[model samples]
Target chain A: MLSYLPIQLIPILPIKMNYRQAKTGKLLIDILPNKCDFCGCCVGVCPEDAIELKEAEIYIIDPRCTNCAKCIWSCPIEVIKFNKEGVLEK
Target chain B: MKEEYDIIVVGAGPAGSIAARYAAQNGAFVLVLEKDRDVGYPVRCGEAISREGLEAFIKPDKRWINAEITKFGFVAPNGKKVVINLGKVEGYMLERRIFDYELAKTASVAGAEILTRAYVNDLIKENGKVAGVKFEFRGEQKQIKCKIVIGADGVESRVGRWAGLETHIDFRDMESCFQVTASNVKCDQDALFFYFGKEVAPEGYFWVFPKGKGTANIGLGVSGGVGKKRSALSYLNNNLENFFPTANILTQVAGGVPSVVALEKMAAPGIMLVGDAARQVNPLSGGGISSGMIGASIAGRLAAQSIKNNDLNYINNYHKEWKKLRGKKHDFLDKIKDGLFNFTDEQFNNLIESMLKLPEKKRTVGRFFMIALKNKPSLLKEIAKVFVV
Candidate 1:
């Protein structure tokens, strides 16, 4: 006689960044390469032209970027890094 | 196939028109666009502003004002009232529909091309930089090249988002508001009334801004969290009508106000966001007209200077200058908003009771704020803590 058993389902988790780091506009910068995804997500989402992609690479052209965190939030690859020296880790 | 401008201002609201006016006054080719068939056709504000804030920009023409206010009334939950004399604090109730349209006309007189029923759909980019905008005018889509784009789109701004700026505002930081121009209300036309009670409007307050004898803009702004079960209009309809039983509703409007912390940033390369689009509204009062117009003036002047100098970095300077000018006041008001919204009904009642105990001559809103701060030092302490965090 076979006994029926209940199966447990584990949920898939998203790659989570440190909330404290994100709040302070600090993140690991080494992850991003020179080229942007060219998806135009950051371009469309920016209230300011702080982020611009040229030749498949994204650059924070303006130092006055308010760091509203919209670009980081919208980036599909999570490659945009926020650092004092400007993407130092990447 | 038309003329090109140095600066293109989208939306003909207070911010857009003011930006156009300033840019044009500086000899920049300015074009102002209005999507609506007419400027300020459907009014959506309580229309109350400090005379001082207005005077700082320009002497407000008499045609815009509906009535001048010289006193204020603060009503508690149990019907207790406190009256504050105007002293040197002067105010006005305006007809915004006329006021906004007139402001746009002023911009046109300054040599800015004002176009109504024009809808801007997308930004025209050259070499990955914003060079102009593609828009629909009278059902024909056209491209107009510009050196700078000033987004003065009011609360529901799409221009900023399209330019790649994060313009997201949390629901909790918003105030869902509703207003009606009612007649036969039993209130002094020269005095503005503010009612505070959880039952009346949880996490928000009801306002009666009188236009003239027996007529006023009666409105309520409820905190978004408190509006889960019912809308702000329903809450106002439930409580305000009973207060002025004889009042008859004339016009109705529903809108949202940002009561959150101001946006950390307001500008980016080749783009500047002003007015409600940049969340420049006062956190405590949710007022933006004066602030927006002032911001536009500064932005327009700076944008023109930047373009003349071939400085693409002008957007950053505009943000820095605006913050240096108005950031402190905004931060202080934001602290007050956070404390006031977090207060429970019991705490609010206690605050009212404490204010009621004060002498009539000393019961001003400014004084009330001082007393509340003194009594509940934790409120200020929390503000300090935010900086540390």
Candidate 2:
């Protein structure tokens, strides 16, 4: 039941906005916020050091993330995926 | 909660709790900070631990045990199964949520102050040495100063990086893993099962650790590099039906296992890293509960001694003591794991077939490893050092 609770109980001031909406034609990734359990596998597998798992939230450095898709598979729950909007725009 | 203490331990997992317990028992003022609202939640492990490894620290309590394990089963890619009866209870499938809370309770009973929902933001350094920590608790920013800082944070630890330790893990040295606690699952409650080969786990292994009669934790870990070609989830999803056809999923959790023996350095001036933060999990098995607690016990005791003697050198003893305890064996295990990474499915099938030929009583994990590594005499010799004891 604890895993089902949303982690973002406190409003986290967005440090870096996910650029999928603002910028297009570039590969970007997003996560299903509720599905993730904060396992940190994505953070450990990212070769570019693009993902960071804070206690309350996950941050993907948009510039550093290259749509490598490593994090996509590293995830156990398949919460992370390539942004559909970004892909369509491209 | 205090302005100053003898030691500030980050995280309240098994390692942190053990570290804090020992530190407090040794007469050091200790404070433990946990970012989660509770001590253990959102479990991220398969939760099987060897009985011998655990008894060395605390008595096994039924309150935290899910199942008593006595048999081990290994399934090759070709579907050959080799079952080894350990002859007695050898391990336990734990309820980690309760187990972790009990450990932290023991630490608290030993006089260590514990704060939940205390998110550590950064290390407070003075003149190039760790002196304390900056943390947020209950929506309030606070700083606590201490003589020594112990990093027991799990896989995503930043304390080591903040203290300038070379804690970066090569992707190959990490296991991208995920697990699901499912009900209506059928597995031997008294045995632990492992499935191997490329089709099963892709350079790692699939595990079914039964928690009770009809429930189990089923998971798989793939070499971090496999993410480039396929994800671990895909592999598990594809195979889960064949293994547990009636499984009704309950909860899903994903985590990384640092498949290395230990970091190059685990201690710096006024600081020590324990458990996953220091890569203390066994390389071959990816099991950390016992090893992490052992390392934490050493770190906790040493943190107290170093502060008592007013000597930072005592902290370095934790690294050396850990090597003597299990670090050396883990190093050899890492090498064996590297050899396993290249093993073809045919090899795994052959290995299991050979094990099946032996008398069931002789089909122990040691004998299986011997046959598996017969091709590499040097590695086999190194492994003999572990089993010979």
Candidate 3:
């Protein structure tokens, strides 16, 4: 029964974003909103130290993320999405 | 309201819980601090424990068992499968969250106080000896002074760091892993599978351990370091269709394992490390639950003995006794693991091809390892010196 609940309903986040869109047109790694439980494994494996957790919010500083995909690959919950441009808009 | 206690153990996983339980059971005032609000909130393991060692501590209970497996197979990059059949393999895939929670509860019932949401930030040191820990308990700062501090805080432990121990590992020795519990897998409910090859899991390996009928935990460990290419999740994602095309994800998790040992130094004057924090995993298989609990048992009993006797030197026994217990075996495993990681994909295929030549009935776990090492006589001799001695 616990698995059946939508990830958003799991309460991994109290302040949930609907979606993080890639505004830069460059390849971006985005955390699919509401699904990330903020486990911080990505922050641990990021080669560039681009990913950071500030005030319980997960963000990949635009300058450091090389689109190496480690952050997306390292995400345990699998909520990280990779994009060239606004992929979540679809 | 004395803040000082006899023993303080951090992290309520198996090692910490067992240490606390034994310390309290021996009449020492014990306290356990867990950062997570829940005892086993995010399961980071493949959850398999060999009955060979686990039974020595606690009897098997139905509540925490997911599946009991008796057979396993290793598949090489070339699809050569070597099936190992034993009269009994004695491995269990656990529901770790519940298992850890129950273990902590057992410690509490044994007289150790348990606290959740307590994030230990630093050590309370007096004259460069660890006397206690400073922690943030649910939004408030709290510090407790104790005679002994046990660090069972997983792989990235700072407690060991604060004790001035070099808890660092070569990135190559670290296995970055991603696993998922899922249903509709085509694996045998009573058997486990290991897949090897550079394309499959790089230097580590991929595994599928079934929980029950049509469900299992499928995952892989990718080689970790600065120049690491593929991620464990991507490898599993790319290969899941090859093995179980119909697999449906139930739960997914990502983690890293310190596939090494703490033979050099696992303790200081007043502090000790166990479990992943102690780097106590089997280097070859990266399994730790049972071995860690065994270390914890030694640490716990010695912590109690030393305290009860007011002999701080008894704390020294934690290292000696634990080494006497499992140090040699883990060292052997590390050597074997390093050897295996250096094997090329063709070597994996060759190893599998060689193993497959044995009669299916002769492919028991013992023989598989024996024959795998037969190719490397020097390593075999080293294994003999460590394990056989």
Q: Pick the candidate with the highest DockQ.
A: 2
Tens digits of per-residue lDDT, candidate 3, B26-138, equal: 88999999887788878889999898777776777888888887888899998888777766758888889899888888899999999887888789999878999998876
Model 2 stretches astray by more than 4 angstroms: A1-35, A45-51, A61-73, A78-90, B376-389
Measured with C-alpha atoms, the lDDT of residue B383 in candidate 1 is 68
Ranking by TM-score: 2, 3, 1
Q: Residues B66-152, candidate 2: write the lDDT tens digits.
A: 999999999999888988999999999999999999999999999999999888878999989999999988788899999999999
Cα lDDT of model 1 by residue, B1-389, tens digit: 35677899988988898898988887788888777778886777889988977777667777888888889887777787777886754988888998888888888899899888777778877775677888877668888998889988666566766777778666566676778899888788888888887788777889999888689998888765665455676778887656987788899866667676557777766688888777888888888888888789888888888877778776678777777676667887888877777666666667778878887777778886776566567887876765564
By TM-score, the better pick of 1 and 3 is: 3
- TM-score per model over all chains: 0.79, 0.88, 0.82
Error of 3 at B73 (Å): 0.9
The better-scoring model by lDDT among 2 and 3 is 2
DockQ preference between candidates 1 and 2, better one: 2
A3-52 per-residue lDDT for model 2 (tens digits): 66578953554454433432223756876667777887777656565666
TM-score of model number 3: 0.82
